[model samples]
Target chain A: MKIAILGTGAVGTTIATKLIELGHQVMIGSRSNTNEKAIEFVNKFEKNASNGTFEEAATFGEIIFNCVKGEFAMTALKSAGKGLENKIIIDISIPTDTSKGAPLSLIPELCNTNSLGEEIQKAFPNTKVVKTLNTMWSTLMVVPTMLKEGDHTNFICGNDEEAKNTVKKLLHEIGWKEGSILDLGDITASRGTESLVLLWLRIWGTTIGTFSFKVVN
Target chain B: MKIAILGTGAVGTTIATKLIELGHQVMIGSRSNTNEKAIEFVNKFEKNASNGTFEEAATFGEIIFNCVKGEFAMTALKSAGKGLENKIIIDISIPTDTSKGAPLSLIPELCNTNSLGEEIQKAFPNTKVVKTLNTMWSTLMVVPTMLKEGDHTNFICGNDEEAKNTVKKLLHEIGWKEGSILDLGDITASRGTESLVLLWLRIWGTTIGTFSFKVVN
Candidate 1:
């Protein structure tokens, strides 16, 4: 499968590298055509991996992963332009402050009344926008078995059923079991999952580095 | 220990019962002086349990549990008057709609910007407010060992060390291990924990009723 990962940040690169390892053709997307991180990812991964501008990657893949920062997400998707139309777009960004010395508070403008996922879906009505994997670290996004007992309690939300199934297959490929990936209804549910960033950050500070949430029943 | 529970709702009753069972003198506080639920609790529990209005209960206990609905929390606390001063307030309320047939959306007014815990602290400047157990059901709050594997990963937050310690002891009395209860910085950190109500509610719908979050490291 041809996959496009927008943003050459840790999340994008980590996911791109993982997909490349799984024999998927992966493209690392960035603002600049010659983004150093994207170029470095291509150099490290070699075969089935490449780097390009957000538009080029978006146009190239059947599945597009929006891995950009929430602040820059809309603009990057705008750059991706018409390529996103009718494509399966998986969003994994949270609207939390990532700047130096800034408290990791969710940006009120994006996450308070609305979520980045909702905004993206509104921006590209033609795209099948599915929100998932933003609740955990990028490493955990691709490697669900890393934590103790490997809790597969991941979540997915989208308006389209087919799109959610497609993402679920991808999740299974990355070690998330069928019973583990919970479908959290429509895009509106992103409000809940996205808000999880706050708890995630808090737990990140309190516990050991490698961790994720497991719903104990 | 003398304990006051501010509210006759399920959460308030559940915690009040648990405390009474642990041999503490528990008071069930309500909006009205002759609240039937509180009166019923006193009659049912038989010993170490009483009923009163918010102010009466507040003045009676050394430690107060703010289990009132988030919407009416301030008003209830105001009715509690000066009795909250210097008392350890263990807050388990989330700012979400609780009315019948309500959509159960997190109240954006408090939870979006600040938390009910922080608001209570700010409202009664002399009180030591600790936030905990709002992320799960009232049954789970009192009985943390009910879930599968019984992975106790409860969290608490407050500005005062002594107050947090008091709440921590209460947690241990109710079966939560000392190591399981993490102190998440100061009262400001309540923002993250309070926001968890959204995900909690979503998961509540998707999974079986018996569930709580365990941070798998």
Candidate 2:
């Protein structure tokens, strides 16, 4: 599948490269006037991952990833244009404090609410927004890494079953097992589900530092 | 330490009884006219636990368990009056959706956004609010029957270290291990930390129906 990625940050670059290496075409969209930084980031993940402006990139691929920060999620999506309609929109952003020590940005950063992934769902009501990868570290974005026994529990949630199934297939292709991609129902669930990112952070803090969770019975 | 439980529901009753059985004094607080159903719920947990108005219950104990629905947390605290000051407050409530369903009466059956818990903290400004137990099922509110390796990770967050320590002791008294009780730090984390409750529900949906998460290295 041709994958068009918006916001070529660390996680985005990593995901795009994994897909590209798997023989899928990858196009990364960026607003950076001098997008050399984003280009370099993508190159680190996989050589030959393409980068372009929002419209050009979105028009270039079948699958689009909204991998911007939780704060810039809406703006990036809004700029993805109506071309995003009916496309598989992969959402991987968490609402965090962008303004930890400075004057608070109006963004979801420093936000303690239902949040950015949710806001993405609301803003692009037509796009099939599936929430995943927001719950793991950039290093383990593709393959589901087991940190313990009975651990196939990388989760996903979306109102559209077809969209969820598509993302789940990509997850499986990226190494998520059948049992690993646990879908927790529709987008309204994003309220509680998106917060899983925090659990990942806390877990990552203690672990030898792997973005993984193993569900032990 | 005497525990004054501010909200009397399925969860409030469970926690109140378990504490009493563990040899702590417990009081159940409901609105002015708590129905027989409410008293019966407490009776299921403890025969000795007393039922009183919110203020009476708050004034009756040393440590406070904010067990009400997240939506009415403030109103319950207001009813509790100055009783919330200088105490270790164990917050087992989440900011859940009340308006999407019935009124506050049906809140315990739902979940809230990070809004409601923060609201309670704001109302009881002097009270040291530590968010815990909100992440687990009321059945596990005490301790899990089947113990497994790497099985207890309690994420606690509050601005006051001493207050968090007090709640940790309560967790220990019930059945938590020393390393299992993790301090995630600060009330602001209440947003992401409490959001894990959603991830937990997904964890619950998979096999091994009843379980809790333990942060393992």
Candidate 3:
């Protein structure tokens, strides 16, 4: 499978490397095809890895992972241009505002009533937007078994059922248990998962190690 | 220990009943001393149980539990008046807006940056306000052992260390394991726990059974 990862940051590179290792053609996208970090990332992998502009990368893959920062998600997608049309976008972004000091808070306009996922879905009605893997650290996103043998929970929400199923298969391939992936209804449900980031930040402060949430009954 | 529960709602009654069973003098408060629910509640218990107006209840107990709806928490506290001075308020309320329909959303003004817990703390600067148990179902709040042998997690946050310690002791009496109670710093952290309600409501829609979150590493 061909995958497009939009961003040159830790999240984007980490996921791109993992996908490439799984034999998927992965492209790390940035504002420019000449981005040094994106170039460096591609250099780390021998084959099935490449660096390109957001538009070039989005145009290259069937599935696109919005690994950019939450605040920049829309802008990055827009830069990806017409390639996003009718494609499945796995949105793994949180609108975190670091200006609020330690233990970050979400962007006010996109915090509760509105969310980046809903916003992207509304903006790109032709695209299938599935929100997942935004609740934990980048390292845990690809390797769930690192903590509790992957028994912890992960949530995915979007308007398109097929898109969610595809994302679920991708998650399973990344080592997440079938039962661990929770499908949380529609795109609007992103508000809930996105809000969890605030709690996640606070919990991170206490234990500066890798951790995730498990739903217990 | 004398505990005041300022509301006749399910959460208030549930916690009050448990405290009374643990041999603590419990008072259930409502808008009026003649509230039918409050009277009926007191009738069910022979001793260590009483009902009164918000003011009477707050004055009767050394610690007060703000179990009232989040929208009216400040108003209820104001009605309780000077009795709240220097007392600890265990706020177990979420500013939920059910009008938005199923899987309730938080009130716009109180969702992200601000919270009812912080508002109550700000309103009564002299009082100690600790926010906890607002993230799960009412029954699970007191009897955590009902799920997974109480191995799940609960969070408490407040500006006062002594107040938090006092509340921690109370949580232990309620069957929460000492390690299960996570202290998440100041009362502002309530925004995180309170924001969790949005996610909790969605999760509830899926299982329709009793469940809670356990932070796993």
Candidate 4:
């Protein structure tokens, strides 16, 4: 499947490289010509990933990955334009308030249901918006199954079944265990998960080491 | 410290007996005419836990373990009455809508701002409200350290420092490892955690063999 990772940041770069490694065609989108850090990070994985503007990547791929920082998400999707009309966009956007400018103060914006992810979906209503991947730290997004102990849980939510199924196929192709993928239901369900990210960070930092969760029964 | 467990349900009985086994004075309160199930459950343990009415438990203990169902949390507190004033109420209520009769819905009554735990705090304004134990299943409430490999987290929120210390100490005695307890600050934070109980059910049920979480680095 053709996959365009929109936003060449840490998470964007990590996911693109992993998908490329799985022999899938992957493109990296950036508002600017290049993100030196994101470019350099991807170069380490291989030369297969091509970088371009949001429109170029959007038109080129069947699916889109929303990896832009929450603040620029709307602009990024708008740049993707009419190409997003029926595309499956995996929302990895977290409405983190980096406003005070400290990682510690970067709290989830779910204190309001009208969060940034909600704003992005509103912007591109034609897009089949699914929320996933934002729950894990950027470093853990690649083949997260490598970090799992058993039937772990990675949640996905969207209003479109076909879109969700496409994302699930990609997730499994890149190492998600089949039954472990929990379909949390509808794009709005992402609201709960987006808040869960903040709760996770409170524990992921400090004396405890960061780890992913697996819902084992 | 003398501990009082409100609502003689399975959760309350389990927590009281566990605390008593740890050598604390414990009382279990029930509105159901003192079921034999509670007494029998208590007798199997080495702890000396006595059963009584809400008022009796409140008058006897310095710290109260509030574990009534989400619907009756305030009623249970009110039944306990002025005795709860200025005392530490370790609230374990979540806005779980068992009214659909299913264990899954996050009823409107329980939410990010007005969670059942927070409601209990608002009702007994003088009572030091600490929200914990609502995030994990009732079964894992007793021995979390026995199940996992890392610093899995449990959150607590309250307005009082002394009460947090009291509950923190008790959590340790009940086999929660050091540094595993998190104080999210003030009674309102309880709103987030109390609701997390439903969100947490998915992961807790399968992993840690029944609602156990450990932090790993």
Candidate 5:
């Protein structure tokens, strides 16, 4: 599969390298054509990896992974242009307000009313946006089953059935089990997954460790 | 231990029964002294159970459990009056906005800035407030190990270390394993646990089953 990973941050680079290992063609996108991390990533994962501007990468791949920080998400997607239209976008950005004094916090936009995923979908009317991988650390996003006792769950939500299934298949390729993949119906469900970051961060702070959430029956 | 559960809803009643089984003296509190559910709960668990007005129950116990709905939480606690002062109050209420139009939603009062636990603590300054058990169903709260594969995590947070330790002890008395109890810092951390209800409700809606969240390392 041809994949575009927007935002050359930690999450984008990490997943791009993993996807390349899984035999998927990956393009690392950045605001600048000469992004140092993007260039370094392409050099490290030489064979099937490339670097480009956000718009160029968006045009280059069949699927787009929105891994940019939530604050910059709209600007980045808008830069991706019409190429984002009619594509499967797996959004994993958290709308964090870096400006908030001390410990940092999420913006929450209009509070509990709408989610970043819903906003992205509203912005790009033709894009099929699926929200996933925002609930855990980037390391766990691609290899959830890697933890010693990891039978944890990962969630996905999207308006389009086919798009959701496509994203689910990609998640499976990356090692998430089918049973652990919870489809939380429609894009509005993203509100729940995205909001989970508040809990995840608190858990991280006190434990001083990284972890993922598993739903126990 | 003498425990007062304010609110004769399923959560209040269920935990009251479990406390009785655990050999704790349990009082079921309600707005009205003759709430039918509270009367039946005392009849069912006749050995160590009783029913009373919120104030009577609050004064009757060493520890208080706040199990009322978020909307009614303040009123219930205020009704409990100065009796709740200096007592360990285990708050399990999610600050959910039951009045939301559709799909149900949380009222991010002060918008991610505060939580119901914080609000309650602020309301009753003399109370030693500890937040726990808001993340799962009432059935799972008392008998978490009853589920076929039940080795999930439960979180507790409060400013008073001794208060939190007391709540942890109560949790252990109800079958929660020591390793599964996560202490997530001070009372402000309640924001994270309360916010988690959004995801819990979403998971419940799609899965049509009761489950609790466990943090997988």
Candidate 6:
């Protein structure tokens, strides 16, 4: 599978590396094709890895992972242009407002009533936007088995059923068990997952190591 | 110990019953001293249970549980009057906006930057407010062992350390293991727990039975 990852940050680089290891072609996109970090990422993997501008990467892949920071996700996707049409976008961004400093706060406009996932879905109606992998640490996103032997839960939500199923398959390839994946239904559910970042940060503050939520019956 | 539970809803009655069974004198408060549900709740456990007006209950107990609906919590507390002074309030309410109908939505003003727990704390500056048990179904609050052998988690947050300790002791009496209870810092952390209701409701929409979150490493 050809995968496009938008951003050259920790999350984007981490996911791109894992996808390449799983034998998928991964294109790490950035503001410019010449971005040093994207170039460095491509250099780390000789084959099945490349660097390109956002638009080129989006056009090159069947599935796109919006790993851009939540605050800049919309702008980055807009730059990806019409290439996103009909493609499945696995949105893993949280609209965090860094301006507040310490104790992390989300962007007010996107907090409760609306979310980045819904916004992207609304802006690019032709695209299939599935929101997942935004609730935990970037390292946990690609390797669920690293903690609790992959017993924790992962949530996904989107309007398109087929897109969610495809994303679920990709998640399985990345090491998540089928039982660990929870489909939260429709894009609106992103509000719940995104809001979870608030609790996640607090838990991180108190705990000694990385953790994830397990839904126990 | 004497415990007061404000409101005659499922949560109030449930917690009231548990307190009585645990050998604590329990008072179920309501808008009127003659509320049918409160009266019935008191009658269920004649020795340790009683019913009264909000102010009467508040004055009768050393600790109070604000089990009223989130939208009306502050109003109910205010009606409880000066009797709340210096008392510890175990607040377990979510400010759900039912006006929109179907698919739960929180009151916009309290959804992100603020929460009902903080509001109750602010309204009664002299009282100690500890927020917990608002994230799960009412039955799970007093009998956590009913599911997953009580392995799931419960969260509490408050500005007062002593008050939090008292709440923790009470939680132990209600069947929650000390390891299962997580202290999420000051009252502001209530935002995280309260926001969890969005995800909780969505999960409930999909699952067949009651469930709770267990933070796993």
Per-model fnat list? 0.67, 0.29, 0.81, 0.09, 0.79, 0.72
Q: What is the TM-score of chain B alone in each candidate?
A: 0.94, 0.84, 0.97, 0.87, 0.95, 0.98
User: Please, what are the lDDT tens digits per residue for candidate 5 over residues B101-171?
Assistant: 76677776823678889998898889889999888988998888776445888899999998888888888
Per-residue lDDT tens digits for candidate 4, residues A145-207, read: 456442456778787899889889888777777776877666656655665654565455434
Per-residue lDDT of candidate 4, residues B1-217 (tens digit): 6888887676887787678777888877766437676577656766567767787788788999888887777777788887787889888867676667433656664554356766777777788888888777676788665446424667777778898998898888787766778766667665556545544653433333454443333
Query: All candidates' TM-scores?
Result: 0.95, 0.80, 0.98, 0.73, 0.96, 0.98
Poorest lDDT segment (10 consecutive residues) of candidate 4 chain B: B202-211
- A1-217: candidate 6 lDDT, tens digit per residue: 9999999999999999899999999998899999998998798777999989999999999999999999899999999998798999999999999888766878988977788999999999999999999999999999899998899999999999999999998899899999999988999999899999989988887864788998888
Among the numbered candidates, top DockQ falls to 3
List, residue by residue over B1-217, the lDDT tens digit for candidate 3: 9999999999999999999999999999999999999999999999999999999999998999999998888889999998898999999989987678655788888868888899889889999999999888899998898988899999989999999999999999988888899988998899999999878877877864788999997
- lDDT per residue (tens digit) for residues B1-217 in model 2: 6788877677887787788888787788888647575577556653557778888888888988989887787778888887777777788887665465411111332222333455567767888888877767786767654557436566777888888887887788888777767676666566555656556665565465766665444
Error at A136, model 5, angstroms: 1.3
- Tell me the tens digit of each residue's lDDT in model 5 across A1-217: 8999999888998898789999999998899889998898899865999989999999998999999999999999999997797998999998877788644567857246788899999999899999998888898887776775347888999999999999998998999888888988998888788878777888889754877888878
For B1-217, candidate 1 gives per-residue lDDT tens digits of 9899999999998888888888999988888879887888799976899988898899999999999888888899999997787898888887776553423665665765577888889988889999988778899888887876457578788899988887888898998887667677788778888887777777777746677887777
List runs of model 4 lying over 4 Å from the truth.
A20-25, A30-47, A51-53, A70-79, A96-128, A143-153, A158-166, A172-191, B20-25, B30-55, B97-110, B113-126, B143-153, B157-162, B179-192, B201-211
TM-score of 4: 0.73
lDDT of 1 by residue, A1-217 (tens): 9999999888988888889989999888888889887887799865999888889999988999999988899999999987787999999998776652423677676664567888899989999999999889888888888876456578899999999999999998988887668788888778888988877777777746777877778
TM-score of chain B of 6: 0.98
